[model samples]
Target: MSVETMTLQEMKFYTGTNPRPEDYEAYWELALVEVASSKTTMEIVPSNLQFSGVQCSELIFSGTDGARIHAKYLRPVTKGKVPVVFLFHGYSGNSGDWCEKLAWIQQGFAVVAMDCRGQAGMSEDKGGVKGTTYSGHIVRGLLDCPNKLLFRQIFLDTAMLVKTVAELTEIDSYRMSVCGGSQGGALALVCAALSPAIKRAVVQYPFLSDYKRIWDLDCRGSAYEELNYFFRSFDPRHEKEEEFFSRLGYIDIQFLMPRVQADILWGIGLRDEACPASSQFAAYNRLCAHKKMVIYPDFGHEVLPGFMDEGMLFLSGVKDS
Candidate 1:
């Protein structure tokens, strides 16, 4: 019933985390270099949608293999440099899912929420960045080429969104932040780490941080089904883990943590049985940026109403005095 009831320790168990921070950091840095090297500019044109008091637009951006990616831009009615916040959805979700929770318009911030490629509730006609790799199925894709991993395209899409947001007329290029929950939270972490423009980030029960521990724990969400599928299909020896870790190094939050310069507000749900506390802790500890954490004893996976209010209050007044 209260925010205090939620705790991070319980959430860690529900999520999963065992690997050391050093391993995570080393792996992600390699991934960042690879991602940076492969990035290319693609055209993003405005769309036809329009909202009252806001300009609604869309973009056709470059993605894995030239697959067209779609994104929605929400701009303040007034012409000025407004702070920006980009919202990303969890697995099986899209930008439309977070319409009600957007605080950018009300808080005087421009918001752009993007749909991850190959997710549920997305336009089937529109191509996915790579392919669908849910939590339960993470391990299955390790064998694929690094470029083929779903997270790679998702991360690239996030970077593109940030780049695009900076170019928008209504947004201030210097003031940007990213926020999301679960898979979205993980993406927020990745984006915050890679993008220099983000001023702050608030992540809730983030996923894909510590890979080995989570796969072994076999947590609650269908996202982990990917891991189970991978193990059953291939008896990966030590060589496989070594190679997989090498590839995952680019995308994991640990390596990205040191790169993040923005202030952070991280939330951990005690009942989070999917993205565990240890992994979350791994990311938090590696953060070189100014950061703080909120533990919810009773909540799990989603950020509760109370935590949201607190996070907003913190975000509104987050500037250094």
Candidate 2:
């Protein structure tokens, strides 16, 4: 049966058809080592949206290649070090305004939301890659060496953000969670996989998984739209499809998830078109850590009702698994 028509029961056991690069593990290990060598410097700018009980600041730090990455840092006016939740935004979005983060702070959790580079945020993108002309991030640097992929750099930024947050005087490095929806959800899982410090990941309908499956299923719209554009404009005949997908496998979340040691609170909207539930299952099923799945059978790519509330309660004890 075609994946599009598969029942939810069938999706539970469906691993995608994406070709994982043989050296996926080694690629990330080497990439992690490369980022570890890069020096990270940070500056805290006073935030204009501060409130009486919460400390809000704009944080800028160096990501891979000295890109100036930006993040919003907020913490409750608490007496001791508090658990923290690292936040990532959706594709083409920024680290949202400070007012929205107050709820986490009010819950006694420190929050750090990073603005992804070259999207709708303050982070910098230092370009030095081949084939950089793509409609969206998925295929940016498609012709470059595996290390030059944009998501590779973004994934590295997630690790760097974790390292930076771990150093804050008011944060309990031993207790940290990561949270997001869509692209944010993917990066949360990416951060959890790459950074050993993360304790729990609250992933909501994650994107960037099982590209081959997405294509075959014709889910070439929304975030996956770029994949369709890349083929029609570049390869045109699926002649080099294997090569492209293998390269993409390096940054694919399913390949990286095995390294994740965090407790996972993964949510899926069964009707999700942008990121098909089968594509998400490709990554989720590989996780060996403590995990819980919250499914919204009637919803699409939109927010999962009550999922965030459930995740917040789950991240309270951010001790790394």
Candidate 3:
């Protein structure tokens, strides 16, 4: 079959080219401690959008560096605690409409969809990095310490969401799950890795993996266009290419896959140009936990057929009869 990336056979073995920082594990450990120490305050205000058998609220909470994160929370009005699902959005996108999240709520699962900080959402991003925030989030803290990497704080935001939700009286923390595509997909994996409470994760064609490989393929548009912008703006001569990509490794999802304990459901499209199949496999290959991958030979970065239904089934933990 014709391929936009590596051949399917090569993809399975692709371990990624992004250099993992030497203190990767330690860096995240300290970040988690910061998240733990933050004085997080949550405010859930009732939303005007009302649906039968479901209660909706606008959730706001403080994240690392005092960023006010926003999410739409929806729960079934039932008495007992129920499963919760965390939903993330694609690059430069928000949590999305309330209607799209109702499916999970209808399935007896409470849903929290996060609007990434400083994106096309209500989440506040207190930008104080040393370099440019002009093009992309990946390059935000490149000129400064790795701890200032935007994704580091974003990943912690997701973990803080999990921790907060787990503490909710109406949530069955043990049954928690997360799902998303592209940038959101990467965050889903990060959330699962950071929070042991996540029982399942569904990610599709995740971005932010195998960065050097993406540069090799020259497929850095769309979600990864920021990589091009960063280099051109900051390191036009490619003099510090290795240094920049290596710093990005600190946020690379492939390096964090091993820490994820949840059963993962990954969808990969072989023809994907936005997020190459090999890049997705780079992270998938490292997962040691129970996992399943659904391959789409002809599909690109677009939706995989029946994946939504499949994901719902996975999150619901119910087999189709």
Best by lDDT: 3
lDDT string for model 1 (89-189, tens) is 78767777335634667787777777777764332222333434334334425677655565666776787668656765667888888888888888888
Residue-pair clash count for candidate 3:
0
Candidate 2: list runs displaced more than 4 Å. Answer: 1-3, 128-135, 317-321
Each candidate: RMSD to true structure?
Answer: 4.8, 3.0, 2.6
lDDT, residue 17, model 2: 79
lDDT value, residue 108 of candidate 2: 90
lDDT of 2 by residue, 211-273 (tens): 998988898777788988899999999999999998888878988788889989888888888
Worst 10 residues of 1 by lDDT: 121-130
- Assess candidate 3 and give its lDDT: 0.87
Q: How far in Å is the alpha carbon of 166 misplaced in model 3? A: 1.0
lDDT of 3 by residue, 1-321 (tens): 333556778877879888988998999899888878877689999999989888999998888677778899999999999999999999888888899988898799999999888788888888832222334787888899898888888999999888777888999988999999999999999999999889899999898888898888887677678889888898899999888888999999999999999999888888888888888999999998899899988898898999879989988988431
How many clashes show up per model?
Answer: 26, 0, 0
After superposing all C-alphas onto the true structure, candidate 3 shows an RMSD in angstroms of 2.6
